[model samples]
Target: MEKRDSMDAFGAVSLIGFAALIAFNQVVIAVVNEGLQPVFFAGLRSAGAILLIWLWMRFRRIPVMITRETIMPGLAIGAVFALEFVFLFMALDLTTVSRTSVIFYTMPVWLAIAAHFFVPGDRITPVKALGLALALAGTAWAILQRPDSGEVSLAGDLFALGGAICWAAIAFIAKATTLRNVTPHTQLLWQVGVSAPILLLAAPLFGDLVRDLQPIHLWGLAFQIVVVVSAGFLFWLWLLSIYPASGVASFSFLSPVFGVLFGWALLGEEVGPVIFGALALVALGLVLINRPARAQVPQKVA
Candidate 1:
């Protein structure tokens, strides 16, 4: 395979891995959420991820360097990371995984818009505009499909949307600021370390205190720590370091696709034609928005 194709393949696999991890985590969380508090669950997962990654880094003899400049950006990113998961876990509690994933994967749309304003070379092209419109339309459609049982939580959907916006903001900040200079492992470490304590403190306010934990809760925590946070994020960061950012980003749409499939398979959630159709639009939009533009050639004089 060509280099780009190989990179694309890696990106695809990384995305699939992320999708699988998320689907599995959702199921585990759904079970564990019944026993433990969401914030506590999030904190424990972060703690586990931190421990695992720290061990791996120690085994590999990787240095943990913290500079004054890196500290602020790392903390900033960590704060956002904490908020993102808090909102996400709350969303999962309030809404279905399928709905939450569809709304959350709208990160690319927000990223494109944020890039248009922030990044130097990224402008709002017509194709990107179209992509954003399609994504927005799909999100609206999903929201409208909520049942009339008066239990549908707009707050949860908005929280998911906020999480997506924060995700885009973090990506832009990482790109524009000096934060990118820090190693991905260090960045991740700072995020989890700083966020874990904060989540622990906020657990009570969010009604996420671990009053009664069970064996399955421990199993769920293990999966979140080992698979979802540690391995999945490590692979993601590795891909970002090696592959084109746009190429890697293009695969995120697959998360929702897999979310729906796994939600159906595991949670017995219903998947209608509208969900599939919305997923198609989201996938197409991601492709259009992230695909590289054709290079212009100079005309040759005979």
Candidate 2:
């Protein structure tokens, strides 16, 4: 297959994997909600992912070493990872999953802005500016449409947005730093391993971890570890290596679209008109953001 075709295939696979991830994640979060405190559940999930990835790397003979210079940066990235998920779970706890997912997936918008400053040759063009406008408008539309019955909290929405910002920052750092030299597996390993203990430390502030866990909770933890975090992320990182980063990142917009659909199907969550409108805007923004800039052609001599 041509490289373009191969990249297209990778992009499609990434979208499918991400859609499955969104659905599975929502189910697990719902299950966790039944008993486990979100933070404790998050901690367990991270630990499980760490162990699973460690075992997988060992089996595959993938080296997991880090240079001394990379160590502090790796730890910093892991700290951001921990905070990102902490705010995400808190958002999940405080708001509807669909709302949180939609708001959180706005990472691309933040990423575009951050890239203007950090990523060389990735400065925001006019098209990207338009895309950012549309995204912000859609986000405002979603917020304004929130029901007066108190189903959505502005604080929770802000926290979810904060998670997105953290994610964008982490992506920027990963791309800008020498950390890119590390393999994706090692990057993820550092993230989960370091974040696990940080989460455990915060777990106590939230609730009693042992008392909250149930059998279903354990099942949720297992799914998150085996499927979502371990296998799913590995596949995503591999896809990124094979495909154009912009193409792969563009597919991330599909997650919220799928999240809304799965939220309606499984959670019986209502899909209001406002959400549909927001979806349209997000779709348009994604197109604008991902559209390749037209190449300039020199005018033919008369």
In model 2, the worst 10-residue window by lDDT is: 1-10
Considering every candidate listed, which one attains the maximal lDDT? 2
Encode model 2's per-residue lDDT on 134-213: one tens digit a residue.
98788778766786646568877887888889998888778877788999999899889889999988999987766566
TM-score of 1: 0.91
TM-score of each: 0.91, 0.92
Q: Residue-wise lDDT of candidate 1 within 49-96, one digit each (tens)?
A: 888889988998887768888888888888888888888787777777
Q: Native-vs-model 1 lDDT? A: 0.78
**In every candidate, how many clashes are there?**
0, 0
Q: Flag clash pairs in model 2.
A: none
Model 2 segments beyond 4 Å from truth? 1-6, 210-212, 298-302
Query: What ranges in model 1 sit over 4 Å off?
Result: 1-11, 149-151
